[model samples]
Target chain A: MSVGYVSVQWNRHKRIYDACVAGGIVLYLGVFFAAGKALYTGRNAISGEILAMRALATCAFLMLNVILCIGPLARLDRRFLPLLYNRRHLGVATFLVALAHAAIAIGFYHGFGNVNPFVALLTSNTNFTSLSAFPYQTLGLFALLILFLMAATSHDFWLKNLGAPAWKRLHMLVYIAYGLLVMHVALGILQTQRSPWLASLVGVGVVIVATLHLIAGQRERRHDERGSQLSPRAGEEWVDVGAVDDIADQRGSTVTVGAGERIALFRYNGCVSATTNVCAHQGGPLGEGKIIDGCITCPWHGWQYRPADGRSPPPFAEKIHTYRVRVVGRRIQVDPTPLPPGTAVEPARVEEVQSA
Target chain B: MPGLILLGASIYATVGTLFGAGFVLRGVERVDPAALGAPWTFRILILPGVIALWPLMAWRWWCAPRTRGAA
Candidate 1:
């Protein structure tokens, strides 16, 4: 876990995983370019360069869609976690393919046109005011730049330097990039191509991405609702999370306190401790992870924090808000107001029940 | 001037790729040893992209934690 500085440590699995991706890309491009040539033979006046460019563009766009889906897909099903681990490769490959498409497009459309291709790429399209005639090339370029930035910073090294929260916020810009790409394709190629099938495909892609995000949000909302519904054993300030017996060893029972922030009540050894359920790294649910080596480990990235103080161990400093907790008999009571992150607090011990 | 810039960029990429081959062989394998195995031909597939952006990777490599990976 400590080797964060080295090049991606390649193992047999990553080797095979990357090989499959390469093979898939080649197969997709081969089949797509051949199909385009065959389908448009004689009927359309499209050339090889244009056809190849379109094939790569379509392939890259499809990959982007799949890459975006992997996040929500993994959240909905643990089975998809393997795909999530190597997702950065897919993103980098998409950018490379998209770069090829851009290269060919510029060569054919803008090359030898009395102006420098680089300059032409900008000044050639200035009809941004009109929706139909909007400079879609500019949008595509904007999206590509975002993709480039994301690919550049995809490594853990960048993640550690940027800090996970900031890194996550930076990567979230992809949603904006996706929106720009959708408009670029709809206004640019779809206009010239004039196919209902193409428009339907774009519409379907948008719907799928939107639907997956909505469903994931709703699932989290339901979990929050259930956590808030449990009643307190004492005053309004201290909520009864559950009987200490109900909390699994090393894991926590989440409870929503004031302002609806969820708190994870963990039982480690004979004691109980609580922290913000939202992990500092990508907001992962910390209540789900087991304690490893006496520290609560984040399931998403294996980041550890002391349950009592909610602070990560040395060399990696991350903190989460902790709550004051105490046990009354077998029932666990937690104070709603969370201490600032990294504040030390005593853990509540689970009372051993005596024989009748 | 544009042609010269493109030529310079290509040259820079070539050097990065040359350096990246060893980095990928030595250090890259440690970044996520669990996921990747010993370098193979297929791993070279990522070389162009990796080298093209090697400056950032180099910087990250320098900035990353200095601890030796666990056995």
Candidate 2:
């Protein structure tokens, strides 16, 4: 929320969040290495280098799973919202750990060969057609490249410059990267080791991620469908959303207008105002956010916009479309037509409707 | 085969480094007023991104309207 950019607008929450991430990474790696040594002894012993590589690889995979889960989990329940706040840090950390694993594996396997390690990584495994001996390293490499691009552009500077839509489209490549990494593990270790436990772990992770996303998607679809039912039909001027009391003070209730145009109706200072449900920063659900200090704050990153005009306060040049709202006999009705972004429409006073 | 790729990457990175140094020092403020008066840490933190994206930065630097206080 700064007028100007610093490296990061680091605060107490971010500091604590990063500390927890660091501690968890260290603990996971330590336990992994220790368990490997204790479990696999003498005849089936693994070297320290291999153990380190495996530890980092597993840690990165688990971190990625958690990262993917955080969004759907947050949508399902607000308690997980705290996890969503510092997710990019976790993502960057995942890349670093994965890079470490790649470095170790490449060096150990191909560093001593006649050609470059990367070249050996690409050329040594030319058996792409064979399912049993496919070039899984290439999948991992491409995934790493995607991760690197994401980590590189994770800053607000890039977000602001690229515009939210383009930035979002670019970051959505994470799904592809996730898919690649999944295949990388399936084809790499699962093929060679034939470890049931590892296979089960990957299977469970994929299931959990898929299930959570499906559940969240269903919930959102239902919300939109409900809004659609309440929307104004042909020739109808205003659509009745619900009673003003349905929205809590300083809180919002989302309604879908004509053809899936989602609007967030906010109640504040005895008046009701409406704005587009989409946040300008990250397309976060603005309806789920509350009015903080006379401004509607985005739940995702706390970017605020004045509910009256849908404008972010001075020095923050973001805006969302405003909708015309009216209260008639305690019932809130919003015009299906949207005004331009930052257009000021008079709010309908709840007290006026109550008195009438 | 890998040596050629590595050499090309090295060259690109070298050019990026030089361009990034100048962009961070003199050109950043012109493109983004927010970067003006930003600390050394901020500049250093953005160095890698700037290096990786030097061409884009250069394009923005060349085209974006000059902000106040930028020399």
Candidate 3:
């Protein structure tokens, strides 16, 4: 029912969202052309050094758009599926532009009355003759070829014909293309410009991407470690820990539920609370994340969940499945049966004892 | 002036085609060339547009319809 409601809301504004995206593209194109014209005025734009730079910029822009579409599409609901449904049109358009960029680059930069455009492209700059000439142009050529393959197979028809796994494996070459592009830009343009600001921008962008991936990777490793520690034991099944007092207030302790699911339990005042240790967003360990005013916040995207009920706060009502926990004498026992939304479960309480 | 105009035309066509194709692929219609309005508008729009397209393409692929009969 909730998913359906969310879907309906998304559908209501679908056209507006689509139109906004379309408008943004038109505006960007207008600027690109105007800039190109302003830069190269009067010369053969199709076959010039300045045009080559423009082409590279175009390829880079298209690639960036492709990257942006991944996150929102992954999370879109049934009503939002239309955004994903027509995504191929966008992919095809990007490819065509990239092709234009590559074509003009080859024709203008390497052709220009030179003998055999392909040969000229390959052998025009042989400054680095050692180590098989390194063939810098070939890197771009292969990248372009890979981009062509990806664009050609962007439609569902090719996806069905080629099979998903094979198609996906082939499409994975985008990363390779990305690396090649970086090398192409670094060697081709950056070396010539030697501008500190440009270098800093490139360096900063790479660093941010690397950092996000590294954090995501660390979260996955922690989940694996927790899983291994909680494998099913004979007859005993659930692991028994000595009193709720063992858990420090405000800090969460990792507990292994049956079937190797790792959960973090936090004790506040006299109330006990629990939630999945792994965050839904990028698997950030909830166990490691700090508690803020009785809510556990995922460090990755700042998604917060009430530890007592495992329900996300208002404006974000997503909920993670919760486990049943009870205190039997000195032993703390947790039930593996998962609770659904709106089901009320009483939190276990520990009696306070004064030390002499 | 004619020489400059010719050079400008060529650059415009080349850059326009590249960016135009990019805009279409990202489903970005109704683009406002004057959004930033002259001066730095070219760098502002084109640079971000170029940087943003790759992730958009990847999003498209991931969100594309799954092949039937495949898990």
Candidate 4:
């Protein structure tokens, strides 16, 4: 992170990630175009423009599916975290492709009329009563608008200006967009085409996305339940977290205290410290992240904060709430009350507790 | 009706363009200190977002804490 915002702080990994996305898009479009040409010929001939639209549309849809899956996939397994890192790049690319497809489609189908292409596109289709004749283009248009909003605000500037919570809520409109697109496909193309493959593909995608999310949600619920089961130690208000040794060196384990407030207990340098599990940036799960270079690093965007003070290092000004923690025997106990952001709390020494 | 809608959109676009020009040049630095020394290319890239969100940005600019010589 930089003190001042640049367009993007390009790194070797970002470069490689972007290159792979670009190469994949180009390869997919090429294959789609070639396949369309080879299969649809003579009586079943399709125009190159229509073919291009189809290619971009399908590619954008698949990209969005992958984008939606990445979140739960990362939560399910740490190995998928790299995919979650630069997922916004894929999102922006998908929007661009979808925009191109929409532009070509509107220009081809509606531009020939005297009415404005957009107006024609929306107003020409009025047979909404019949499922087959539903105005699917309007659904597609709404979804595109949502995608455009997201893509436009994908930069850090918007995130900072909008505040993380509001920005996150706004971005969650993607689910609505996805739903609209599904209807757009089912009603528009599926009605005309006598193909089970497209229907099966969409069904399978929905199932996989739903299944992964359910599994991840269940796992998170179980984790929270386990943490919640640990009551305040005897009469003391300090909640008993799990064993100090259970948290690996330079790693964190989360515990839920009073009313489901999750706190991450991090062990570093033979001492234990506690901080809020929510990252200051994007609210990433700090508990899932490990401490690197003596700082707790957020898994989502590599935002780092000192484990003791919960403050980002110099020049960058981000902070999270810290909690007073102590090691009682082998178990780490933390005060339920949270100190103000960046408040320094003394780390409890594991050796001292063991010796006592 | 289509013509009226198109005209309204054109007016919105024009207003957005004017607002965006001022925002990228001066209003940005006032609202966000991090945008103070941002590169021209970055500013250009953020213009669409600024235009789309001009009302909010303008409000922020208006309510920005006054630094010495900022007023």
lDDT (10s digit) by residue, model 4, range A241-298? 7788798888988889756579988998999999999998899999989989889999
Winner on TM-score (1 vs 2): 2
lDDT of each: 0.77, 0.88, 0.55, 0.89
Sort the candidates on DockQ, descending order.
4, 2, 1, 3
The full ranking of all candidates by lDDT, starting with the best, is 4, 2, 1, 3
* DockQ each: 0.07, 0.53, 0.03, 0.58
Docking quality class, candidate 1: incorrect
B31-65 per-residue lDDT for model 1 (tens digits): 43432453354345445546766776576556555
Candidate number of the best TM-score: 4
Question: How do the residues B41-68 of candidate 4 rate in per-residue lDDT, one tens digit apiece?
Answer: 8888788887777788889889987681
- Residues A1-356 of candidate 2: C-alpha lDDT, one tens digit per residue: 54677887788989999999999999999999999999999999999999998899889989999999999999999888889888889999999999999999899988998887887887887888988999898899899988988888888877877678988998999999999999999887756786688988998999999999999999988887777677676787888989988888999878886475788999999999999999988888899899999999888888899999999999888889999989998999998788999999999988844454
Q: Candidate order by TM-score, highest to lowest? A: 4, 2, 1, 3
| Whole-model lDDT, model 4 | 0.89
Ranked by DockQ, the better of candidates 3 and 4 is 4
Between candidates 1 and 4, the one scoring higher on TM-score is 4
Model 1, TM vs. native: 0.71
TM per candidate comes to 0.71, 0.93, 0.46, 0.95
- Candidate 1 pairs with clashing backbones: A7-B27, A7-B28, A8-B28, A9-B29, A9-B32, A10-B36, A10-B37, A11-B36, A11-B37, A12-B37
